[model samples]
Target: MPAHVPDLTALTLLVAVARTTSLAEAARELDLSVQAASARIRSVERRLGAPVLQRGRQGRRSSRLTARGALLVEWAGPVLDAARDLDAAVTALRPPQPDADPVVLAVAPTVAEHLLPGWLVHLRAGPGGEVALLGGDATLDDPAGDPAGAVRDGAAAVGVVETGTALAGLHATTVATDDLVLVVSPGHPWAGGPGVDAAELAATPQITRRPGGGARGALADALAEAVPGVAPAAPVCELATDAAVRAAVRADAGPAVLPRLAVAADLATGALTEVAVHGLQTRREFRAVWPEGTSLRGTARDLLRIATGGRLR
Candidate 1:
């Protein structure tokens, strides 16, 4: 091994660029200026003797990782994981700080926004008192496809994900159930009317969550089974958060299929109306997950108990 190794800071920046596919965006995240990010990237490329990013056209779009960059990112993932673990291990050796916050949770957008606030209140008022929630993306920004990954990577003590099956490396306990409802603005024709035909609903383009989201995946699977060989139109717009999708639908961008819990307030306020789909089943399971074989203790155990209503699976 060379005495001079590539700086982890630069490697971290590379991974950020790969995930975001934008030099400026990655730089912003790393708290570095664009010029500094570019310089760091060039330095890394020189060290590796290969370009890591394919810059997009100026003023047009963002840059993306090249094939070599993808490989570099793959190599960097484990390095970063190890670094995080090392930091955690060191932190664990310190004396416990009485004022340290409660266990962190990683949760889906719907759970974070609609369910957690009330749940936390209940938890605090009960056996688990005055618990603090951290890292659930409560603002509905930067939603994670697998919140359980946060638990697996030790970033969170537990995760609440909307899925029937347990994610690999985690044990899941069913906590709640949610239905995905087709919603439209009050002025839309579907509002206060008979249910939409399954075929028509499948054919219509609507505002939706980005691909690979649990809600989007559930809807896609239902449509596939309901109308085989018929594909739904591409979404009118794909938003990352339920809140964003709701906003788009409220603006009359198009009808949307969303978790009922996410739009409960809007439905009550008449800001949105549910349009039943005759033959589509939109119900989904919500589960609390923790890393397999790990015994829950203290706040984590208390949280799981509260989330599952004292039912353990």
Candidate 2:
């Protein structure tokens, strides 16, 4: 090791930059100017032989852990965490304090795409707080996909996991519900359906959502009860994004069953149509999940209380 090894402050800044991905975002979270925060990171990287971040691209600084840099981050994260853990333990020995880790809520594609904006606008406007999010539309914003698990593991303070299939053993509260309606392109005859029937769905080149999947489950449940031997054939397209499914339906690829919340504006503007099913009106509830034994106070609880209308116990 060199005589001038990086100091603890430099190491902490590096870890923060690594966790946040962007220098500007890290600065915002840490309450520093982008330039000053970045300078600290560069100073640390300069002590190492390789670059730890690629700076000044697209007006944003993105990090790249070089081969040696990767080795250093891997070795350093636990060491830094342990030191902090020791400090926290010592602090805990003295007194109890607020435990808000600044929650990151994970939602399904439809919820994130459609429902999140209003909730987020509410979170930002009212909570004397800020929230950093990972994942949008089911793609991992962070390398680890389970943001709710992050709460359980203490990486995040809270998160919301959306699933039609039950998530057992977590403290969960139901939040809202939306319909999973059969969607078709504006040009389809079912677009102005007097009423869609099981036979009509059977004859069409349908785009069925798979069972146990978020938006798909409602449709799958309806079909299971309506047609005794109906097994959904392979979809013309399989997609994880509501935008993709909506686009596919618009391109006349096939009928897609999706949340009404996701396509509400489209349905109102006549960009798409919800086919009226004679015997099916599929729906599902959205549940807010937190780790077992999680406690809330002040801003986190206030935002949750506002979102759920004060029912969270």
Best by TM-score: 1
Error of 1 at 10 (Å): 50
Cα lDDT, model 2, residue 3? 56
Q: What is the C-alpha RMSD of each candidate to the true structure, in Å?
A: 16.8, 14.8
By how many angstroms RMSD does model 1 differ from the true structure? 16.8
Q: Residue-wise lDDT of candidate 1 within 129-232, one digit each (tens)?
A: 33434442334344445678888998778888878864898888898999989999998988999989779998899898876553787888889988889989
lDDT values, one for every candidate = 0.77, 0.64
| Collision pairs in model 1 | none
The 10-residue segment of model 1 with minimum total lDDT is: 87-96
Tens-digit lDDT track of model 2 for 180-275: 777888898677758677756755566543333446655666777776577756677666567777888888888887788878767887888887
Which residue pairs in candidate 2 have backbone atoms (N, alpha carbon, C) closer than 3 angstroms, thus clashing?
Answer: none
After superposing candidate 2, which stretches have Cα over 4 Å from the reference?
Answer: 1-101, 134-156, 161-168, 199-203, 207-214
Q: In angstroms, give how far residue 242 of model 2 lies from its true place.
A: 1.4
